[model samples]
Target: MPSANGDSTRNHLAVNPVFTAEPAHIPRNTLPGDGLAPDVAYQVVHDELMLDGNARLNLATFVTTWMEPTAEKLMAECFDKNMIDKDEYPRTATLEHRCTRMLGDLWHAPPADDVTGCSTTGSSEACMLAGLALKRRWQHARRAAGLPADRPNLVMGINVQVCWEKFANYFDVEPRLVPMQGERFHLDAEQAAAHCDENTIGVVAVLGSTFDGSYEPVADICAALDRLEAERGWNVPVHVDGASGAMVAPFCDPGLVWDFRLPRVASINTSGHKYGLVYPGVGWVVWRDAAALPEDLVFRVNYLGGDMPTFALNFSRPGAQVVAQYYTFLRLGFEGFRRVQQTCRDVATSLAERIGELGPFRLLTKGDELPVFVFALRDDVTGYSVFDVSAHLRESGWLVPAYTFPAHRTDLAVLRVVVRNGMTHDLADLFLDDLRLAVERLSRQAKPLRGAESASFAHGASAHHA
Candidate 1:
């Protein structure tokens, strides 16, 4: 047996094993035969994480990067709790229900004693649930009408988040994605109604488009749908993919009629971790009423499982985000959320204005709607593309993204910036300074780098899908 002193020395984690002449190098592909000391293992992982970008300076993502210290503490405390274990943690479940009902009220669901909604891992999962519901409801209607539902299709803009595509592929529903027209980066009322028929299950309206952070005309889309139903007898519902704007418009643009006020809107989804002012990996979905979600109907896919049950974002996701969302609701109330979101809007618009004034770029959106904006290089400036500017900004610890428009507008490429809660006025000024210097340096460069290093970062709505 080894001596007691030897065992003690081996167990001591305070010792810096890396400082020794021969450093330890273990393959991470397989489980190690030996165990490491707790503190030593922690130090190794912590050091590796130093390579991550500063979240506050990250302009590419829409997820929340800053939270109150108290919120952080609460999230840390509940990290061990699983959302699926509702029976074991009754209080957490109750809080989740309360948050759901609160969102229902905020979205202006029809006044009722019982509201139907749920918390999700994020908007992706919530969107899946809502899409499933739409499909099932359409199936029921087709079956009742003595018609075949074999060719079920969903109408939506091509700019929708990737999750919708995944949902359609998985559920075997045909996706009727409306393509973008010239100068029309997103879907419009005419395009949405034109794609509908008897087989159309629902139409998706994006409250905020990630391409330009502009709101689609929800009321106009609804009116078109109403006319279609009156003319063709096809009563199609609308699903609002408000992953970012559902939390925004009710507070910032209360006059905007995009939510439940439009009876055609059957469901809506939002990321609580995005504009809702919480951390990542949390989202909310609310139905207009109990009839909107066909929860009682059995949906079975035998290859996966004989009798598969459906769920929202709460299956096995981190429960702490839900707790953190509850804390935000209680701590901020309605007015507090408005102030924080408004501040973000102010920063976004101010920064966009300053960037437009730089003379080398053209303004696409003012950030007045979603606290996000996109700008393209002026046609006369040919020395550098938006990709070069994006790559150069990455050097200064900023992460503005540059990408080309989809479909009909692929010829246009632009750089985008998202002004979140922590990006204050001072930081905006610093960003403006860096942008000016970048333009000047790249303007004088010999030739275009062809956006050499821009591929490393994610592109378009999928990056900010939250």
Candidate 2:
């Protein structure tokens, strides 16, 4: 009985609503609920508060936040490339050129015919591409040298990120691991050279190690490779994995020649998100020249004029991250990056000094190269261990991760602190206070198995079995 305007009509069917099966093809115009509702801004802001309220020391891994104004500008402007054009926006290409030039200058590379580089999702993909390039180049050189192609191998540290192992596994090459030991927490140049034979493709030198935030002696590694190549009559190259250190050393320690300046270092890869002060998911890799990246490794895609060569593993990532990185370069310049890095170093040193003074723990790495600190419980702590202290710290809301040292150093478990940009002095003090409280609380607790009989049984049973 209702008219078209009434609730009973098709346009006004709410009154006698029947939950029919969704029509075979519901018209776009006749949607029911608001397609997009529930704004997430408030929820996101709430989460930030929760994160801060909990232990805010955040030495777990390398994560960071930009300053308010800087973040606002990055989010607002660079995210939306309204002015960019597929035809004219050559901004992608332009940004690539700019970054390549800047990195070349930062790493001190001589001008050459084939200075090539690409932006990536992160250092992982960049590393993959570097590995592929090395593989291809080695194959090409092998054919020319009339050497057997079956025994291709890559030399690298045992403590290397799993990506290196995956690279070798995927390429069906031998991963000649150079073991790390006391005073040698990185690839030993002599040991790595010893693994090299006619089939050795390249040696990966880490500019910054993840475990202890130390630099592998790239100069010494390069020297070793130089000697090997001279004696073997085959070309061997060095790939610098400068993921975190590349960004730090340029500003804090400029005199280092670990990059392309070293004769044997043919390529370098870094995570822009790590130390470049950009958000996650941006990385870079640059070859000394076009020759370093074999031509076969590049593929021409139909999207960007099939004639243009593409080097990246990922195809359609948001251009926003790239623009943000370029913006960081323009806004911070060289001096700004240096100042920020210097501040990070100072803060790290200050925290290390404070931790040292507090007692019950000893510092691991001297905060000189990278702003990361590792510490272990003092030798005298009887019932408690570093792991126990790590658990206590977590109760206070800090997300510090505790793990055993790599390979041969499994006996030594240490806690690491990675000081990112956002952590302030006040936050550091709070973390220290919580750490002290954790130690004191742990010490006060009596051990469940304090008797000599209990101790004797545990060790005596093991000895009896042996």
* RMSD of each predicted structure: 7.0, 10.7
TM-score against truth, every candidate: 0.91, 0.82
lDDT of 1 by residue, 190-244 (tens): 9999999999999999988877888888999999999999999999999999999
Could you tell me the C-alpha RMSD of candidate 1 in Å? 7.0
Where model 1 places Cα greater than 4 Å from the true spot, the runs are 1-23, 297-310, 459-466
Query: How do the residues 1-466 of candidate 2 rate in per-residue lDDT, one tens digit apiece?
Result: 6556532234422211222332222222265453222333333235446645342355765644554466556546655453223333466656766887788778887786545888888888888899888888888888887877887999988767667877888888898877668867778779778878878889888877777778888998888878887898757898999888999998999887788878788899998887888877688899888889999888764434535567877766656667777878888999999988888888888988888887778888856778887787677766676667767777887766566665677666567777777777888888889988987887876642222222111110122110
Predicted structure with the largest TM-score when compared to the true one: 1
Query: Positional deviation of 278 in candidate 2, in angstroms?
Result: 0.3
Any runs in candidate 2 off by more than 4 Å, and if so which? 1-36, 40-56, 76-89, 301-307, 446-466
Q: After TM-score superposition, what is the CA distance of residue 176 in candidate 2 from its true location, in Å?
A: 1.8
